[model samples]
Target: MDDDDDLTLNLFTPAIKKNVGKSLENVIWGNRQQRIKARKLLKLTARAKPTKTPTLSESQSDVYTEKSEIANNKKRKIADVSLDFDNNKRRNDGSGNVSSTPTKKLKDSLHFSSLFNSNPEIPTIDVKPVECIKEEVFSSDSFESLSLDTYMLRNLRETMKFNQMTHVQEQAIPPILNGSDALVKSQTGSGKTLAYAIPIIHALQAVRPKICRGDGVFAIVILPTRELALQSYEVFRALVKPYQWIVPGCTIGGEKRKAEKARVRKGINVLLGTPGRLADHVIHTKSLHLFKLRYLIIDEADRLFEMGFEKDVKLIIDCIKEKTLKKQTVLLSATLTNGVERLAGMSLESPVRIDVSQDETTCAVTPKIDLHINTRDNSNECSAFSVPDKLKQLFVVTPCKLRLVSLVALIADKCVLAFKKSKMIVFLSTQDSVEFLHKLFSNLFKENDSVSCMNALLSDQQQDIRKSKCLVTFYKLHGNMDQKDRTLTFTKFSTCKNGILLCTDIAARGLHLNNIQWIVQYTTPGDAKEYIHRVGRTARAGAQGNSLLFLMPSETEYVKTLSNMKINMKEIMMRNVLHNLLLLFEKLPKILENDRRPPRTYEEAATTLQIYIEKVVNDEPEMQEVAKKAFQSFVRCYSTYPKHLKSIFHIKYLHLGHLAKSFGLRDAPGGFSAGKNPIQSKKKHFYKQHPCLEIHNPKEYVKKPLSSFYEFASGH
Candidate 1:
């Protein structure tokens, strides 16, 4: 039955006992019969009796114990051997038996001691922050204070009433009023331009002596952007305007060369322009002699480096070095990064740095910017059929033009802001989409919808055509235009109410518009800085604005950084009001002349109206496909339009829509849609195009030098 029971039955069997006894009987004991019986009996008695205990000597007992210990040690060794044997048995049988003893493979495991203790390297990093040089106040009356020229005083009073003295102005002015070499770190819009203007004016007024080439340009303000130069020039001109005798002229890009040459030839006290233009005049043209130039100002110092104008700035500075009078250099900037500080050190000798941290006095009225971060399981998956439902207005940014155009087609009766060249360049994914879109709009309106494309490659005439149409303008801006012209155009387009202005980052900073209702990123920016500047254009002036980013999953880091900045965006969805609105308008005729029902109010609209709008308008299969694609692009771009009756499209009497209606257009469409842009349409174009680029040959235009007495003075 079982192994143990079988063993027991075999051991105590009667048959085994009988066989043993018979064997014993057969085997007589020692020698004779009697002896054999005795032997037999003895054997039987031995088998039946217990063995006697043997007495041993003390030494024998010790030997016995020693032998017992040796036996026990041998037994233990046998047990260890048995373990080894079992391990081998397991290996042979293919059974897994993990070894208890620890064994580290040198190649696989890293030791902490070896990693940390051997060949240790201590890394060193620089942790010092840039320091600002302290400035001391000077008595305003330390030097003879003549009743400032009545005209300059009036302008100064007005400026003081509107704006307070900036940190640069507060400290540097006394030195400038006293005539000192002052290097500064005040940024744009910080009044650095006015600081030097005031001192130059004071010096000009103090002396009534005749000026000559030996005296050079009295005051030269060097700037990187034509806009900034113009701004500075205008400020300087206004300060000295009460006294028309002190004529101050500005030479910048985008102007008639002949007109600028004529103005420079007439002689002025001050000159303002970019480095290249100013340098060309100084080196080739002898019109404005720099030999007598007393004051030199470099504005927006950091911007000079950023725009790759350092070499130009340096060259201009070198040209002025040849002047007869030792010039005083004043450098101004906002953030004195290491590179800029180094540039300053190289440009100015023993200069003082004045940093005015943003304090209570600075304007803090910029619109309240709130960032939202969307948290949902649908984080990365936006349905293709959903439009940006959370967004009222939206902009989509993309690196691919065809993608952008194709996206526009699916969204229904929406205006487009497209790049001109790319409109013609065929997209790999959506070939002929642009032309198709053009045809679609044209057919809808019985002619091409007033739509425009703008880029830097188009001709001025072409741009004008687009602008004049006021419905849509196709345009381009080349590198040739002056900075002022560029800035103005950017501002005009950005604030065009319902118009779309497609542009590059050149229009990003120092330009804010209230009318830019949405921002779109067609593609994710490669870095964080570019992203910040792009979204910055909208959501300006405290108005509720939205931005959309179309990005891939691989761009999670970029999305994270944007989220960290508090930009709340959801994956695009098609079930949105904006998407539905586009479909409705696309199917509806352009005008319903007698349907005079006031547009639905935001309150009257159903809370879930945006979703219903999508369902009702996208009822058609073909239109649904387009809606799906549009929503895909919208989600990729990070925009949303809410679905609800709370807000509806209504006609208004202002901005882009109003202008469009005035120009023979009908009611404004619902949601964030483009209206006619009026830039190229305005009568201002009738005048000779404003000189947007000023290229001066220095030989023709030069400014008169200020008096030496005032230039050398120590205080105001």
Candidate 2:
């Protein structure tokens, strides 16, 4: 072997074995060429590079250091904009572990672009000059009573049935009526709306002599959700009926914007809605004015500030404050958290802080220091819990897979007491969960007609619900649905005699749906505060309601955390069988074929949303413009977009590669194919061995796969 061959001979010995008589150098060169070609091929094919074990730590670190941002699009200057309407400051408020620091230029560009893209055909919205008429103030004359006129007093007593004033009403109403800014922290469902509502109505009545416009709003009440907005609007609607001059208008997302504008043009005395939709009008349209805004109520004030509405709400407050110096600001929330004290200082002038929450203080000392109890005060008075006194809260400890079966069983059991009006609100943590649970329930109850009482009310007739005469109703509500569809779903669920609403936390706050017999926490809330709100959905206004919280062995700790709120959660003794649950799901093959079919893959849901968007824009051309305003939120609803959805959705991210990585590749593979049922292939029946019984428990309850954890309830 020559000098070059001798040195390189060992390298090619493995390679030379395959091709005998080949020179060592030649063999080494050929293998190197093949490797180069293979690398080129891989790059061309766009395959992920295989990561190797670290020869040194720095070499391994380099693999992860270069983060590709696929969101930045050079094609458009209006790219990667997190618009004012969509950007909730809380998400990017630097409170999270990751970077929420959005680009300043992107936010500005997005806001302007959306505003600029609004229909030019919409008339130059002009805010009618609101005249603040001065009269004998109610506070000065008689602050002792509600300080409302005789007619108003009668309405408050007779219509609202307010016999004795709530502590929140007593403390908050006086300062507000006297033209003072008030920061109120009251319990949920404590008539906080009335404390502000009664005073605002009274103040408006004082200005009755002034010329009023039917097309503009005088007072704007901002809430976190459309459901809450609707509830507050109802309070105003019913209160203002006595004064025919007072017109209340609701302007929230999920309702027709054009229709809302028309209502504004018709002149509304009070505008109750979410920050985003209201800001959409204030900035993008001139259809409304705050020139005479006497009362500005920020209900769920902490939520408005915390859940990323700080920018929108602050923008609103700025717009109103600029127009009217005398606007009385009222901020009401359960907790004045997330720097809300700072907000109160900024917006409210010498505001009276009303904290009527009667919960007992927990000891900060260690358990052994005080037996984990506060005994020093020696007061026997049990503090009021955040969960209402009327609410019967139950914790159903079960596996996630068993939750659906448990829900069905509970419904069957409770249907009798509901008296033909079994209204349930099943709260899930994610939109995907909401959609899945809705499909599962719909499948189980396909034969039971009129599930969606909304067919007659909704613009879409695809469900054909109007024709059905049966009672059991089912509906789904989440952020993804078209606003119009969402509104219809909310209305249908609100009005239905026996309806089931499968929803996310989106429907948790301020939704005052009557006869809500149960609030099923299909998925445990993220924390104790969320649990409070979920359970708060029922037992509202002195009505009896039940809340079922599903818990896994790991999740039982959350129940322990509810100690701060003193929530009485009774653990339910589940009397269920697996066979009964499987049996309840009758004729799945036929139902799967008949009801179009449940989403067999992640792509299916994304594709469905894409089609939904297309159909909405196609059916109504004007909606295309509105859709642009909400473009970011729309894409974010389904973050993992496949090629079909990605192309159809057309999202512009700030860093394309980072977004791609954060979400996922567009061409990800599907789940099991539609035709393949992983279960037994027996097509005729669910099971021949276990003859279907009237038994409601799960069919395979006895099949103890995770049976060890099933005993978790005993420990609790």
Candidate 3:
């Protein structure tokens, strides 16, 4: 053959054609060969024997035996010292022993140990047995018997419709009317506001010359939150309707500063405000004349300190004291703490201690049946903190994965399926959880064609249909909401006949809502004391109410902790809740139309409900994002438990994957390193070396003035 013909034959041959496409295969094959070679190197190093035998001392033998035992028991492979890069340098001695560096040894030790080796030990709370105080009977004395002004009595009876005096009012009013500084301690919803309000109104009205709008402020009421302040202001306004000369005004953080300043300039007879705003007015508003301030009332005294308002309260008190010498300071709280006493010492002088909760007449009226007999060491404080006589406390032990489903089931059982109207408050741990759950449930229970069809199927009568259609309105309130939004939510939820309020601890304090049938602690409070206040929201003013607490298996021990503190509660199985929920769903097929087949068991019900929720979350990216943020915030909040509760609520014991499921997430998000405290995560530090390069105005980065850049670079 010719030379050119031989070349063409070689190119067209099957072997040559196969070789043409082998370049890509060769690269992949080379990677596999390198991986195999690396594995072999590791095996060789693991099995490598020392060149020379070194005599082992007795201590060294003991250490080796202990390490071997640990390896065997833990089923962990001991790190091979020969595989370490530093082993060769350490083995340069005549003795051919491989020694690991300190860091390597530490790493191996940590690898063999549990991730949370430093978990705190469970703390034992020393709960003192408190003597039960007898319940005080309501006084038969009417508003007329209190020696209040005629106009005030008419307003109370006709306008406010407050005729009968509660035990607190009977005890606290007489002392304050006698012009003595008073410190009153009573359980919530016991007419404490009226007890102080009536006396202050009477004192203001009895002034020789009638008080007018131009008289400036006379009575100052300071509460912990803007909502509470607004509530008190409304009460004052209603009571002063008959006595038109006594004008009532309110100033809070979220309102228009110009309006508040104008009101102060025009002169307010009675002022109701939160500490921060009150103090701000005292400092800035020149027209706010406290010289004639006759009464200074601090409601929710313990809460003021708990909310870090000590400085503001002190500033207001100092300003008031400097302005007036005849001021009567009154402090009222549900539970009297040392903080209250300290506040009294600083603000009140020779105050009359009026504790109607401990009064014999009060205790004799109601037998000590539902008293929470947990007392602190303070002798001056009430011996026992009492819940309402009619409040029914219940708790449910549920797994983390079923928390959200169980909560939905419980709410449905109480609000929708029940015969009577219901009002509920579901308290979560973080604001993010409250916000996310509020939006999620609102969507779930929104009025739709399906809901309309289900309502028709459930009820044949028009009235019943109307009731069912209007039932289960959802509202959310948290600290992060705007002031106007918070006030609007409070008003809407208060007026709602059958509704659920999803909130954080912000609602657990001094706000009162009429006919709240149930209080659901979706997440237990970090402090045990907060449990009392949370349940206190319902069963106010001698009304019947119920409360439910949701707990995980890891948190069941909290029941015992609460029991030790004299908080009575009963546990309900999670299966029964799921079963009840399934029954409810059987009637309303439209709610769960994806599952045509009826759930035969509670397990099936739980699975179906979880699947529905997860599908909803997965279909909406916004919901998924919210779920992630809520889950992360919940973990951070859980990690911030009080030191005494660290053992029971240890974040290490939390199943993040299962907890994520409750938030409608399929798997836990990453970035949570083991043994790292989420609450105390390290913050990013910014260096000032390149000040000019740091983008101060992100929107106008390119338009930054050169002069400003030069000044910043020169450290001006």
Candidate 4:
């Protein structure tokens, strides 16, 4: 061996191996030894300590600290571990010390490490992280933390996980809990239910078994519509379960009166119902005591006034009045019009008012509806003509029934389906027209296409069938079917697809249907306002859509005036209109004339009609010019028409009443009455002298009083 090689090998061999082994030991086992020694010392300290009179300070009691609690927890663990260590150490001590304390045989009743093990898998005692959860600090937090005693937590998680607390709820809950009355102005879906419900439940809990008999209820909710009442009832029922025995009941129209009374007879802590129904129960029933009613909530306040239920709502409030029964009233509304706000002011006393108009976090802000105006070609006259496509020819030569059939067939033919097919909504002039068109359209689609119908007259069973079987829902929704149902039906229609929603003016203003691509005015609207609403159905939610207006030849004047309004539409001439007119007139000669005035021989009639047609066709320039002048006269005349007359005469029939009759005009039923009373009719001289009796507002036409949280139940 070479001396240099041997020296190099000796330097690197055992020294490198020993250093490498020492590092591996330190990396893996160094911390473990320290932990074991700490455990032993902790055990010894615990054994030497006395447990009988441990000291506590003023600060320790005043505020619970995380450190103190943790130290207290470790004390127990140390005592157990210390006992084990002390026994072992004493046996090994060199001094043969005989202790006065007799040593009991140590049985492994519990493992020290098991009791103190941080790892749960090591069979250690399970100690919840109670200290980690911060104690409820504020009064509101303490109140919220109070478990919904009988109510399940799962429901809260379900409802709130998807829908966050709305603006009204966030603002109202605290004040209500603090026993303050509040007035909320928020749109639909603004969480008004929870706003009143949470505080109501809390108040009920505060005044539990002591609830006075005639002291009726802690809360009573009133709604403008039955559906809203029922919905509110369900929410209260879910929330009131936490109050254990307190039950809530609802009374509304279309339910058995006896059954409703029976439910109320069982002692209701909360009552939800429409004003009329609630009034009926209170007025006739012996059980309910308005004297004790503490909380009164009027929901949909604006709608109540709109529905002309202001009187009924006030009567119910008056009936609930009592002295010494100090109550809080909360009124909720989306839009508080003049009359509605007046009513609120009358009812609630200086209630804290909360209006969440600009809160985007809760309310849904709709996209703008684009307005497009179309000017026609070669037409100096402007009026309703902008929407001429929606109007049909005046003086239907064919029977009205057959014309309706043909119209549906035409719409069916023109409908084209693509991946995202747009739907058509036909605005009918009357319920009869809706029924006739719906049947015809349904038959046509049943054979080759898909269609549905919506109107007011169908039975509930029929409505359900249409809603489920047909993609198109046919329902006859009107202002009469109660407010709640109306809101719900419209909400549903707003979402459905490829739907032909045949609605009246009820679906026009303030209601939105997003996906409509074509709006066909089955007949011209009654007025400019009506016309705007009908056309507004199209181009909703920032989408492009078309409006087609059906017009009569004589309605040129009314169309011209509307045309001046800058609406966008085009003339869609039905090419086969002449042929269809001939077919119609061929059978309607007797009806058109109203009497058997003349029956021309067929051969002679055909020849005469041909000559007339030729003259009409040849004089197109003169005819068009005359049509323009007549239209101008109609606009001037209609502009000055009395409000009463304008309300009765549809804008399309401006100066063409006879033409409208020949074309099957449908008049609204509310305003005009052609027939006079026998006594009034007999006095012909009085009528002539009085110049037509003007409808007058009475001197006692008292404005409705509003309800406020400040004056509720107290002033009355």
TM for every model, in the order presented, reads 0.43, 0.55, 0.72, 0.43
RMSD of 3: 16.2
* Candidate of highest TM-score: 3
Model 4 weakest lDDT span, ten residues long: 707-716
lDDT tens digits, residues 1-716, model 2?
44333323423344222322232223335655543433333222222342343222343333322321122232233333323332234232122232222233333432211211221121121222222211110112222365577888787678877666666677777777888777776556667888898888887777837536643567888888877777788888888778878888888775677887787767887888888888888886776777767778888865664455666777777787777868777878865553465556556766666665632212121111111111121111222235455677777554422333456656644542234546888876555455544544453454544434544566546455433332356788877777768778888888777778888777777677778988888655543555666776777655678888875433455554454346656665544422233332232222232434454442332222223223434345444333332222222332322232233222231222112111112111122111122124342332332121111234443332321211010100
Q: How far is candidate 1 from the true structure (C-alpha RMSD, Å)?
A: 32.1
The Cα error of candidate 4 at residue 16, in Å, is 99
Model 1 Cα lDDT, one tens digit per residue, 149-186: 56566566665342335445665676666666665644
lDDT of 1: 0.41
lDDT of 3 at 496: 75
lDDT of 3 by residue, 1-716 (tens): 54333323333444322422332223323444433433332223334321222343445434544553444333323333113221223322122333323223443332121111222332333334433344553677887887777888887888778778888898888888888888888878787888888888888777877878898888899888777788888888888777778899998887788899998899899899888888999999998998888899999888776666777888888888788888888889988877677767666776778777667322112111221212233322333466767778888877677788889888878888888858999988877798789878876654443435555566457545454453378899887788778889999999878899998877887788878999999987855567878898998877889999997767777877776656667767676787677775644454565524777877667666666677678679999889878887787567556556767887656766567778887656554423333324322211121122243343443344322211000000
- Model 3 TM-score, all chains together: 0.72
TM-score of 2: 0.55
Which one wins by TM-score: 2 or 4?
2
Off by over 4 Å in 3: 1-134, 360-383, 447-471, 586-596, 672-716
Please give the ranking of all candidate structures by lDDT, highest first, separated by commas. Answer: 3, 2, 4, 1
Candidate 1 wrong stretches, greater than 4 Å: 1-150, 156-178, 186-192, 208-216, 253-259, 358-501, 509-553, 559-716
Q: What are the clash counts of all predictions, listed in order?
A: 63, 37, 5, 50
Q: What residue runs in model 2 are displaced by over 4 Å at the alpha carbon?
A: 1-145, 160-164, 214-216, 255-259, 359-385, 416-421, 448-471, 576-716
